[model samples]
Target: MKSKLLLSWWNDLRLKNKLMILYFVAVFIPIALTNTIFYTMTANYVRTEKIKDLKLSLEGNKDNFRKTIDSIISFSTVIYTDGSLVGALDHTYGSEAEVLTAYSEVLNPSINRFVPMNKQFYNAYLYTDNTTLIHSGMLNFIDRETEQQDWYRATVAPSRSRKWMIYTHSQPDPSYISVIRELDFYKLYSTYRKILKIDILPEYLQNTLFDQTFPGKLYLLNPQGDIVYSSEENLPQRLSDTVQQDMTVIFSVFDGVDYLQGWQIAGVYPNSVIERSLLDSRKFIVYLTLANFIFPSLLILGFTRSLSKRLGLLFKGIRWVQNQRFDLLKTERANDEIGQLTEEFNKMTTRIDGLIHDVYIAELNRRQAQFNALQSQINPHYLYNTLDAVRMSCVTKGEEETAHMIKLLGRGFRRSLSWEQDMIPLQEELEFVMDYLEIQQFRYGQRLLHNLEVDERVLDIPIPKMSILPLVENACIHGIEHLECQGTITVLAVQSGTEAHIQVQDNGIGIEPNRLVQLLGSLESSRSMESYADGKHVGLKNVHARLKWHFADDFKLSITSDHSMGTTVEIKIPVSLQSSDDDIEGGIHAC
Candidate 1:
């Protein structure tokens, strides 16, 4: 019973609401939960990896510092054991000139060769206790002030052969990592003590050795735990006093080297640095979560909208049918069930429209038959006899022009009343138009002039009856009736390839631009005949409709006019060469 009730409730919901509920439960909730868990795991993993990378970078810097110190020690060892250097320093000299000559030739040449080979070697000097040796380049006399220095005291201690310490010089004030080695290799020949001090470039140590990709502070501490080198700018002589509790410290101790035995490289990292390292990962997770959420939502909305829109159209179609309107439903090119239903609906509407149209046509034919019966009550022969009598009376009274006009008027009426044939030879249509123009000429004398030009080849073409006459009447009534000057009407017929071209042109006050637009629009509209008859441009609309009924799209009617320069109406129709021999002979003769 519960299952059945649930199913009933589900069936009672609208399609869009049902789809939305399914999406929320199936897609939205599941994706949101999984993405949240995935983002948490990713952030933790990225942060752990960043901390490991920082530790490895600190170890690498420690190795670089060891290598630099070892290189300096190697260079100092060479200077300590050089026999030529020992001989130059131990010589007994008489005057300062002899000292200068021995110093330039022996000591200067040797120092220049080694110092320029490395960018890290700032300067090298030899300090000695020999009173006879002058204080000159690369040779310094060990005065009482030098003996008081810590580096010198450390080097001269009894069994210490070498020492590395950061020392400050007074002349050019900067601290440098100095290497001091005792020159005791020639103990048998020398009675004096000598020391070699080489200063390593402090800028090279600060800029190159500890420059790492990790965003942390690095410090180089000597065995005595003093801050010797730091990567921070404007650091004091000691470490900062305000160390936070959350700061992480990593240490890499130097082993295997006797001089740097207890020295260590220390890295200070903050929690914020680790978080910064995971910034890109966090952004990626956010974007992924949004994509998972938005894309499925858009797809669900699109599907629901498509279903609802088509169903709405179907409901609208049913309402139209209820109101007795058999309008065909427009549908998409789909192979779904809805498309099939729409197709069947359209077919049903088409059949109903056909049945109703047949009934309407039958009723119209019945009414036309009754009207024809009423028209046939009048005797056309009696009307013709009366018109001929009038013409004859005018002739007897010596009114020849009035008699001729009456004869033409009778012929026009007879031609209009006769509708036995719908299609007539082009020659007959032209004759009818000429008769009408002659009557119009009588009405507008001296103000209207007309000309006819016909091509002999198109004289036998079959055209609908009264097609050319309306166009001529429209030209005379609209084009020339209001002209202050004399108006000229030209009718030109020509054959071009497989078509006949006819034009009716007039030189009079032309239509205004706005009015001409309306006239052309009326000709193109698919309005009822009754509406067209009650509105403007009735003659052009009639001619356009008749041409369309006969030839469909094969015939063309176009109007071109300038504001004050005349209007031209041109018609084109396919030429048919199947007229009777008598009609062809008549057309040729008339042309």
Candidate 2:
């Protein structure tokens, strides 16, 4: 039972639901796969790129720091070489106290204050080849070791090349290097003691290094493999072996400078620096993934919703029409392709309705035309000859009233043949019919009675003019003419909605049931060869044709007869008051 229900549920999935499922598989899945593969590749590439950029940035920063330090060292030499300052320091006096006092004043501010302002300058010692180590800042006095340092030896370089050179002193330190200067500013304890040492602040030096933006670990090393300046003071003293092998990384040893004194500004960065660069790539990946999720879903939903609404409207409209409720008219939509289809559908329906209406009108007109021709065949030639003979007889017998009645019979004949058109107002048509009945009454005055009953409101209702006259003619002629007793003809014009009903009933010799059936059969099929020339049913046929023409299937003509009672012929005509406007526009009679 559970399995059957589940199967039924699956079968019940709507079209849109099935489409959404397919979309997830066919479109979204592939897009996701493509993006995932691309994202994965990009993530790896970002890490590699980061490491490359970091190494390059580190190298550049290191070189820039070297150039700055070189410039500052060179400027110091230029200052010392100023003959005035040199001459004052070398101003010979046996005491040397004046020169010492002058030097003290120049060095009064602690090395902590200015020279190596970061407090990173571990030591500053003034040295000479003869005096060895003399005055020291950050230390009271220095020993022969200061003279033995690379800074001491490089200044008095054996080749005696340039006035100054920068050196890295990583001596007894996780520290930085200092510059050695051959000063002409020394007093004469002995003329040979000439070198001055300044421990240049590595941090200050690094700060002044580069104009361009960069990131790296910057360091200055002293000659004795001691680090004097290092951006990473807390990095582990022992590095992993694999990391140590990397040319960009330094573990324990102070890597030798490629130029200058064995100590130099060096930048070290490992592959780990790539982490930051990968972050930018990761952000982009996130954006693409979000687009992947949102973009296609929105596209699919919008497409389905738009198309579905258009299709639904069309279906709903057709349903409403089928229900005979001509409503739910939708205004045209512009953006979607479905709107065009709906527009086309509307056009097709309009054309079909017009064709159907035309065909209906045509068929009705044909039938009415046939009926009219039949009714017109009711030629009272015998009555005309009889009236002529009566008039002659009356003239001979000196009866003026009988002759006058014969003239009236001739007048009625002309009127019946010439009613203006098929469709006419109710009042005019009734008057025309009454005139013909009056003429018949005059022929047999006391033997017949004719009366017309009409609703006043229906007087102006337009109807086919001769549509009722044929049945009335049958009643007056065939109905009462043969009756021995007094005969009665009643004409009723009643209004129902937009319909006009005219009923003529007679109390006379009624028709036999077989004769009534013969009359009511399809008139075209009953027009037999035997009575082909007689044409007595002309007016009846004309009325039937006119009724069919005007009202199509919505109209009726019926003949009823009872052997004991009487005969009744009813004609119904549907009319519209709005046809006045239709006639004005179409310039044709309203039927």
Candidate 3:
């Protein structure tokens, strides 16, 4: 009972609204729930552990850096106070060769041979104020060039003696870190104090810091907070300005006291990188939970869309049927129940279309047979009058034109009985009209004048039988038949584009505008001959209905007139070589 109620409620909602609800329940709820749980469990714990790790990492780097600096100091001390190396710088030679030999043998050997405990030092230099000493790789004269340098000036200042300083080394390798100290052991101030410089490689400095994958940057800075060395080239010069405002910075002084006077290490942890790492660590759980429902959600969406699309198509087909259209549904057939229903719908429409066709043909034949019977009765009555007129003409004129009148009557009767085909050639229809006119001419001599002006090209096209005859009859009986003077009837046939036009023009009494409007209005109001009143606009309405029935709505009959001038009845029908076979009944043709 609960399941049925749930189904009833779901069915009551629209398809798109139902899909939206399903997505929110199946996809969004699980995602939001997983994220909330994951964040609650790990958010603070991850941040605290990460900051602690950064501080510990920076402390370790500081300790190793201090040890490396101490080794440079220890090596510098041995070279600073060497008695033999000092004597070589102090000795003055009379010849350049003597100076070169003494320094190369003593000064160069002392500084070069003394190896430090740490392998980080790559090279060493001694800057002396001896004018006669040559500038070899190890020993160089402290001339005006050395005095102008900041390192030289800082080292030679009286207040900075016996203290170590760090600076970037440019020679041999720019990646080198240099440790400098001034020599203050000599009592003679004039001899000029020497500065000792030791170069350390970048590889040794990098080993003391964390790897590149670390979420923060590590650097060694002096007491002034200027970066002396960094683990990576991309490291920010100032942590406070370069890092985010919420970023964590861990700093500590060096553990080795003598080696690094005020040098320290700093680690910068940007909040963005930390949060990203924390999210990455929690991705497996969140995705695993979401993965379980993704396929099912997609399936639901697909089913909803399919059902809506099929129903939409079915509704469209029903609307078309309401408009009397029976075109078959032309969509792809699916494998589900809707597909079966669609097939059944197409079959039903086909069956209904066939039934409508059979019924329409039956009704059309019944109307045609009824019209023919009426026409036959009129012909016999007209025949009796023509014979009587002939007999009267014989008695008065002594049979002078009896044979001619009888021949015209014979032709009219023969054509009237030739209604086996509902459609005949335009030429034959014109011939039949001429025969009738000739008979009428004998009765009212010199009062009725009729002429046929038909284009030869339109003579061969098929038209509904007796289609043009009614228009001629209407022109004769309503128009010329009531005239006081000589009445003229003109029949004109021509082909205009895809249509054939046959017009009957009379020069006699015409209809009044108001009455003419009523006559044309009747034609417009009812196109079916069965609705027309007997003997009232029967010829005009019959011509309109027959043409309309045969050619659907593509045919037209128009009547135009002037008050007492004349009347023109024009009929337009589709030009065709042969009539449609669908109108044939049991090997006989019907319109």
Candidate 4:
């Protein structure tokens, strides 16, 4: 029951709302959770890799420090085992001059040669207890003052032959790493106590052992955990004092060398530095999540909105159908089932409307037929009788030309009033035009002149009734009527291959270029007769429209004119021949 109710509530919601809810539950929530999990994993992986790299860096620094110390110890060993240096320091000098000779020849040369060879060794000195030897540059007498110093006392301690320590020689001088060894290598000639002291260059030690490229503080700690060398400037000397609670510390201990057994290389990395490294990854993840959410949400919203709009239009169309409105509903073109339904709906409405229109048109045409039949009987007979009586009266009064004009007028009326056919032979059409032109000549006298050129082969070709008459009428009224001089109207008809060409030319004041353009444009328009009821080129448009309806694309009508030259209206139509027997049969059938 609960599931059914939930489904019912869900189904009651609009399409857009339903899609939004689904997106929130399915796409939005899942993507957010997945991104959070991925970000957490990425952060953890970066931190683990960073710690591993830091450990490797610390080990490398430790190895480098040990190597530097071993080089110093090797230099000291070389001096300790030297037999000449031992003999020099142990010799009992008879006089001060002899001591100076031994010092210049032996001790000074040895010290100068060895010290300059190693960049790490700062200076080397030998201390002896012989009071007869003078205290000079490489040779020093072990006096009461030296015995009291910390490095000297440490070196002279029992059972200890070598030691490395940070020491200062005097007050106000910076400290150096000093290595001291007791010179007891020759046991048989050991007459006096001798010591060797080698001080290492502080600058060389700092540069050789520490790496500045590491992202955190680095320290070289002594046996007592004191910072003997550091990468940072002005840092405290003890490791405990320099480290903070927010720092992560990693260290590597020195092994295999007895002197540097307890020393370590420690790297102190702040937590903020690790977080800074992860900043770019965090930003990328956030941007990816936003893109995933925003793009799909917009797509779903657009899709649902379009679907709902189309459905709404379909519903509206149904309502129109319910109210008996059969007009076609305009809709967007689509290829979906909904679009197909809309198309079928429009088709149904059109068919229904056409059926109702047909019924109404059939009734209207029946009524019009009755009115035309009655009109044909009364109007034509009355007109013919009046015209015949006028002709006879003119003949009796010796007005022969007037009688002939009246007879032509009567023939024109009879032809126009006969509504039996919409098409007539080319010859009959030209005859009617000739009679009309004769009447116009009488009206205009010497001002109007006309000529006709016909190809006898096409005289029997059928054309729309009254087609050529309108062109002639326009030439007389619009063309010749405004001219000061005589106007000549030429009618030409010819058969050219499978087509017939007819032209009506007038030598009169031609139309302006702009007006001619409008006239040509009006002829091409397919507007209803009512729309062009008050238009100037109605008759020309009517003839063109009738020709187009009869021949479709097989007919052409064109007008060309130039200012003060002349205007030519030409018609080209395909020839469709019919035999004389068919015409006779059609006539008899019609009668």
Top TM-score prediction, candidate number: 3
Tens-digit lDDT string for candidate 3 (1-591): 999999999999987898889788877787778767876677677877877776776676666777667667777777667777666666666889898788668876686576443444457778887777777777777888888877787776778635677765434433456788766556473365677877677776776555766667777777666665675565444555565687777778765475466767788777776677588657865676667567767787798788888988887888888898998888897777889888888998898899999999999998998798777668666775676677677757777577667767756665655555777788888888887788788877899999999999899988877777777777778887788899999999988999988889998789999999888888776655465655577766766766666777787778889989998888787786477664322122221
lDDT of 2 by residue, 1-591 (tens): 999998898789975887798788988898889888987899778766666666566556566656655554655665445554444334443445764664565434322234454345323444433322234343222246764666566676688665555555545453445565666543443354445456666556646543344454555444444445555645323233223533355322223433355554445555455556667777887898888889888998998897677777888888866875554347666755677777776776777677778999999997998698667646655566677888889989999877877766765655555534545688977876776787777778899898889999888877666556667788877888888999999999888886777789999899999877777764554334353345657667666655555566777777889974789888776666323333332221211
Q: What CA root-mean-square deviation does each model show from the true structure?
A: 20.2, 18.8, 14.8, 17.7
Q: 2 or 3, which is superior by TM-score?
A: 3
Which window of 10 residues has the lowest lDDT sum in candidate 3? 582-591
lDDT of 1 by residue, 110-198 (tens): 77778877745467888988889888767788989999888787777775644444343333434557777777789789978888888
TM-score of each: 0.39, 0.40, 0.47, 0.46
Clashing residue pair totals per candidate (backbone < 3 A) = 0, 42, 0, 0
* Candidate 4 stretches greater than 4 Å from native: 1-21, 43-64, 117-121, 156-173, 187-189, 209-217, 240-250, 267-287, 306-591
Which whole-number lDDT from 0 to 100 does residue 136 have in model 2?
A: 39
Among the numbered candidates, top lDDT falls to: 4
Indicate the residue-level lDDT of 90 in model 3: 67
Q: Tell me the lDDT of model 4 at 488.
A: 97
| Candidate 2 segments exceeding 4 Å error | 1-398, 416-420, 523-536, 575-591
Predicted structure 2: lDDT:
0.63
Model 1 / residue 237 / CA error / Å:
2.8
